[model samples]
Target: MHDRFDFLKNISPHHGEVLRNVLSKETRETLAAKLDVMPNGQTWYADIYQKAIYGPMVFRDPELNIIKTIEKLLPNYRILSDLYLEKTPDDQGFPFHTDFDSIGFMEHPEDMLTVWIPLTPVEEAGSGQLSIVMEEGAVRLSLIREANQLHSLVRVVDSSVPAHPPFQITQQEYDYLERTKVTPSLDAGDALLFCNAFFHKSEDVHNGKRSAYIMRLVRKDAKFNKTRLLALKKLGQNLAVVDELLKQHYPDAL
Candidate 1:
């Protein structure tokens, strides 16, 4: 049961039109033009599971004006990473990867939250929902930097704590997570807000597609400058220097 105090909370019947309209005119062009390039030879629409457009492009649109709404919703916090549209196709494999991998750039990475708002109807046939390991907000994941072997963007988190047997996890811990894992049934306008350090993955869809507008937030003074981040995106750095870029460009990183 994810209570208000827990990291996972679902709000139903959210602003459906607003959520649907997040893919503004500019975002559509970004996808159609295929301009933005991701690290390690990944483009905006490279993979079926994750077709992400630069979030700033979507939110900056004058018609939507989403930043104001987000600021109102989460007081004392601002958008850490704008918004990215992730469309998980039918039966795609989006394995449990590092949830807070990007948070390391934040001055207070521990104090961060991820908001996932589904754009697809839950009642629709063959809808793939997101599955997450539910836990308390106070929990924080212990991770080690383990480079991906395949030079791919997706990688696993190496925990200092005895991870799952598959990766340092004991039977007891795995059992608890197994009991706590939740795949919430959310509507097109529903939002699932969760914290860092938990394992989350996408399910398989049969007939329909799963799309969500995902955003990260942190305290207003969390040392994130959206304009600067957009500029960094303009720099067009590859994935190899990503860690260095964050550590050097971003202040006070541990």
Candidate 2:
């Protein structure tokens, strides 16, 4: 297992301290309240089981400032979208999957990134810790075929899809993955910067609430398909507004 500090190296050194502060208790409490009231406060599940708040990047809230700071630090990356809090019980958690498999954020799959920031301290011994599979190892498994469609960050597939490949694992499988996959412990202020291709999931919440905020970033040069954007808009997902807002921010992209 790698230390949490190793993951920090992936983040821009300029924004590391700022991100740490952004994930603090005060910020989390403030942001959590805003997220709790979003219009689409549900999960869409096709292969996994989980609940979350999605598309927070576009919300009119103080949290956007923190996201902007990260964008400034990583000028090449755009904050595509985000999910607020992820909640589950001791025996329930998401399946192991890559963010790339979920939504085609860019023209090329590799151009996307995600930051998984835990709002609570997670120890190795704790059941609700976030688990990650090493990038090198996950490449060997079959890539997830269909991205679990998320209505908002808060919802997941209501039931597992049998035709889809298994993403969720049993407790035994989790243990086996730990033996082969690198797991890291995280605190409230820490975040994991991972490529969309990295396979990851969370351990079931055995005790306290395990909340995390996930922000998706994409390469600026990548294309955002208008068709998909329109579909999301028709669904009334607030992401359509976010897309327009970002376009206004970077007129060159439009």
RMSD per model, one decimal? 8.4, 7.6
TM-score for predicted model 1 compared with the true structure: 0.58
Off by over 4 Å in 1: 4-45, 48-50, 54-56, 83-91, 123-126, 136-176, 224-254
What's model 1's overall lDDT?
Answer: 0.48
Tens digit of per-residue lDDT, candidate 2, span 168-242:
546775565566555567777577666565456667776657777777777777676444444444444555543
Give the per-residue lDDT of model 1 (tens digit) for 1-254.
Answer: 24333223331112111223333455444433332353212443336445554333345445555578677666676664544444544435555544533334343344566767666655443577766654542123222221221111121222243433233445665566556666767766556665544566666777645656676666666564332233333444222333344555653532
Question: Superposing every Cα of model 1 onto the true structure, what RMSD results?
Answer: 8.4
Please give the CA lDDT of all the candidate structures. Answer: 0.48, 0.55
lDDT of 1 at 128: 71
State every prediction's TM-score relative to the real structure. Answer: 0.58, 0.65
How far out, in Å, is residue 95 in model 2?
A: 1.8
Q: What's the lDDT for residue 242 in model 2?
A: 39
Q: How many residue pairs clash per model?
A: 6, 13
